[model samples]
Target: MVAILGCCDSTNPVRRDGGLPGSVPAPSPGALRAEDQLPRQRRSLTSEDRSAIAVGVTCGCSYAQIGAMIGRDKSVVCREVTRNRGPDGSYWAPVAHRAAHERRRRPKPVKLAANPGLCRRIEVAMDEGWSPGLIAAMLRHEHPGTSAAARMGRVSHETIYQALYVQTRGNLRADLHRQLSLKRSARKSRGSTGRGGSHTYDHALTISQRPAQVADRAVPGHWEGDLILGRGNRSAIGTLVERSTRFVILLHLPGRRHDAPSVAQAMITEMSKLPAHLRRSITWDRGSELADYVDIQLNLQAPVYFCDPHSPWQRGSNENTNRLLRFWFEKGTDLSTHTPDDLARIAATLNARPRPTLDLKTPTQALHELLANPPAA
Candidate 1:
């Protein structure tokens, strides 16, 4: 392969009548040089290097071997070959060289710009409270064919996200951000820190005692519970999220009485309606509202576990649900103003939204599937 390296330099001033003895002929004038299109600082393949790649591909050399021959990395060879290969998988040096230069052109138009129909479809889904990822997945699902439209119709979740967040790529509707769950006008970085402590009560089980199946989400019915506090921590709504299905059930904790008995009674009343298999266990935060956990266990017939002090990630599902619930039940407001019926409606709405983790299935759909053919005892 080293013998093929003679033609790998584009700066060789010594010109041959035809070309290097055994090397592929220099790409025609139409095949632009790297310096012609890109800045000098950016490293791009030279015309000779592309010719070597063409020969290497024709000789059935691996990308790593080709890279060695051209003084580049295996990934560079792989990306060049994969990106510039012909429709029939052949690598013609001249064609590949031209394609590379074309790809280097800047300020290209966004995908949604030429596809109004795709923009409309994306907007409609967002308006229906669907995430960008779910909309992208559904697009791929609906356009599974290999035709140009089908191929062009499918955009990545990242593309949809960029269209929403990046002003340069803004082709979707201007107000579509309002349709997002968080409804932020711009992107934000997220991070978290965990706190450590043990359970305070001698009889209470900590998250460590919960069965391994609950952590793995191998079985349905394990639940994570929490409360979304309202203005001045006076009122709150109880939240329950099933681990496996991500199904949600909201408890109406009317008034400012979010104490132990009030919370436990509301939780028992809502969770008791489900089947025994669907009431396996409940993991909750260390708030005093769940002090009557024993009463909850007695009525629901499920063990109650407490998270370590200030460690909310142990109840991840419930925490996520509370965040979503905040969209409708905003902070600094009277949560008690919404009746039990309002809570039911909000829970149903949240459950109906599709989850990316659920393979785009709504929580309601996943729950119904479980009910249709539940696991045997």
Candidate 2:
């Protein structure tokens, strides 16, 4: 034998048999070799990577050992496990991977995160119970000129809202959401006769009295209205739909009642948000729930019109939207269970949705355009 032991198999200097040694065993025949497939550039773990981790964990592999197997730094594996565990704190592969996907999707830096002043303004307004839309308008109103407005951090309500719902962006504190009137983890649609309520109106301006311009939908301010009732008509929500822009507003009411006074107050607080030009008129059904119509007309300075008795069609836009709202406030559920902040979130969702009437523009976009170039009152 001519000194047969020359660097453990001579030709191959880095063989597992003698060199640095194998970190991981060769993949079992046909096993998914996804460990090396994770995107190195983005620093995000892929679903396939998660599946491999599950296999490694099942096989009693330690984190450092697993990191070696996957060609990743041990610290990276450590962070992934700590950050993306499930609600139960168990590192189930599927749940951890799904959460990673949600966290990795932060497409833009949140407006509140970018501007400290804007963040402060939002926090103050939220504490005062102002909706995100109201905060946005206030920012614009205070900084009127276009260039000055941009410089002053005049962001849209949609942007403020984006921070709240998307997991990847946490510019707004999670506790601040509790300060919002309705506090739902997710939004719900609202409307009901079967889904929400109905009341009869007396001595009210009839929809027939509404102006021709209002009927044509050419102008931006005209709105249609209705209510979604809760179980046995005990609880309710006030819903308003803009005829031209197809925008929606939801009113949070007294938990047990959508009474005339309560409904009127809710509408007053919500509608007071619009500029004078955008407060032209509101057409609703003759449901007695709006017995405070005269008060709404006088105080809002926006006239109110009633639909003919038993005819939901007179408030067609409102009627259609109410049905769509049924997806959230189902007929037999307790409407009172939802908070005002919940209604605000739901309205945001409704406004952000694309509408066929507005050439596929979202109600939020159509409203934005209208706000930019409103028609003469």
Candidate 3:
């Protein structure tokens, strides 16, 4: 067959391109000259090399022959074939590439772990329930003078966070994740709210009715509030965060259905406990649960303002706090199981924790400072 095709029966034939069929094209003279000036190859495997490997293995070709065709060392070819192939010896190109990529990507040790003093600093902040962003901000606030060594020791919050969540290579202890507000086995982004739009209630004061001071966040007592629904919408927990201090208040609804009347009574019971000054106003989404806003307003004396349809960001602080609540009250679980005392404890913990928006002060401290010296309202 080879003779009929006008080619010698050499076991491996290099085409005019200087490579076997499906191999990388031959380098031009210009390419050869440029190679000397370019950086060395990372020795990483390429897709073409993997294709050659699959073909060579199918033809029972030796490692040396495959390596020559792909311009890789024989040892590299052998390792690639042995490491990436399935138990039945199949060399899928996509599988090979994924295996090689996973192997080549070796994680580096965390910077905080290398410097004991810096590690201790990070550990202390975490112990005090400081978020990674807060810790980083505090570091930036502290870094001063022209000390090169001190500056080099500081690391970003992302580095500290990767040390906690990524697979292996974390110098931090597993228990360290406890200090994080959203502790999970793996990190996941906050995604859609999954709540469908329902213009169920009418006669509402829109967020536009809200004072300009709420947007500026200069005035204390104005709070953003929302209900975080639990499993199958059968349970819920109310969240309230003051605009200025980010102080949190959680409402534990022991009842099953969080309908308007039930939620209104819960809001009244929770808000009435607050000092009259701290109960300025409550901003919430237009979910049917808050339909009894008039009742809540009459009882707590804190008028309720509804966000525009499908506009959660109007109550940004409450939305963010609800995400944090997912750390304790995981989605698709019964939230009513938690007692009011449990809710209070969680709220207190959140309140005592430092906030970057609050100038790295705990919400408790910021609220205390604001109340101690009220702004000229």
Candidate 4:
């Protein structure tokens, strides 16, 4: 029977109404399975994938044909066509494609974007010589009545540093780079020597020998001090910052060569103004400016501890304070031009600014509180 069936078609094929050809028997309606009637399986389309397909169609593929190719519903293709259509009634394929590509390529949005107006205000504050940390606290305090979403709340100084140093995505203004404190060259890696050199003052104490209470900041009077050298090595300013309060005191050095005697006399004179209990150990780097460390210790009745050579972190409070100081006295500028009154004004500004780390209190506030309640004898 099978041989007859095969031979019959080869010899005299029967013609169908549509064309002259041998026709295969169609499946009966009841015999056709549900699975057989279903469309072929296709890979699922993600939001991104759908966007791409939409762009591709807008560029010029027929809706039914694209649906067949991508295994999507024909209606999905039609909706995509309608959604991305321009105001001119034209479906711009290239524009849609570019938009999709850029959307997929974007990085996570910045926290600053939450309140752009606030960021601009913070930038203005920076231009006025306020530190990022200070600006962040001011935003929270001054704008308490504003909506939290609208306010530029607390952001760390480090966060501001990252935005300034790390290039922003889609940022068109390269000139904005100037707003950063450190130039790109300053960000490069540099090797540092350990605090190995010995100071000329024989009686000076090592930082390791400082009292446990001082190291832990349990008591309020311990301080870190250093010198900010200016151009020509002829001019310099002595800086002192209380560890607990971060209160800064700028010393007026008469001349570079007079630094030893001048720093010693300045420490004695300024520290004497504070109550006896407020004068504790002072930490300093091994710079020659402090060659008269013994005299400073003797006059103030406070031990002077020398940090390791080239170890700025040991006197981190002073180092951080110096960075803030740069806004007034920039690097490479002659410090001789600044008088004692000018330096004092800068120090006053720093002390008055609120510090986030100090619970949004100004250094002056912390210092006043310390003064009101002296430490136990």
Top-TM-score candidate index: 1
Ranking by TM-score: 1, 4, 3, 2
lDDT of 1 at 36: 51
Residue lDDT tens for model 2, 38-67: 444445676666765655554445666555
> Could you list the CA RMSD of all candidates, in the order they appear?
10.1, 18.1, 14.5, 17.0
Clashes of each: 0, 17, 0, 2
Q: If scored against the real structure, what TM-score would every candidate get?
A: 0.55, 0.47, 0.49, 0.51
Candidate 4, superposed: residue stretches over 4 Å from native: 1-180, 184-203, 256-258, 375-377
The residue pairs that clash in candidate 4, if any, are 195-308, 195-309
Candidate 1 lDDT, 1-377, residue by residue in tens: 12232223444431232244554654332332344533323379988889878776665557866665555777998999988877788998899889888888898768887788888889888888898889888989988976677978889888888898888684798888888876778886532222122344557998998999999998999999988878877888889999989999988886778988899989988998888989999999877788888999999999999887667877888888888889899978988898989988988999999999999999999998888876641
Clashes of 4: 2
Which parts of model 2 are misplaced by more than 4 Å?
A: 1-202, 375-377
Clashes of 3: 0
Query: Considering only N, C-alpha and C atoms within 3 Å, which residue pairs clash in candidate 1?
Result: none
TM-score, cand. 1 vs. native: 0.55
Cα lDDT tens digits for candidate 3, 1-377 = 01101112345464444446555664553554474535435577777768667766665667766665455667888988887778687888778998777766756445656776776777888999898898887787777543566576566788788878875544676778878875655676534444424554456788998999889987788999888888788888888899888989887777676877887888888778777778888898877788778888889887888887778888889888888778788977988899988998999988988989877899999878766765542
* Candidate 3: segments with Cα more than 4 A from true spot: 1-200, 374-377
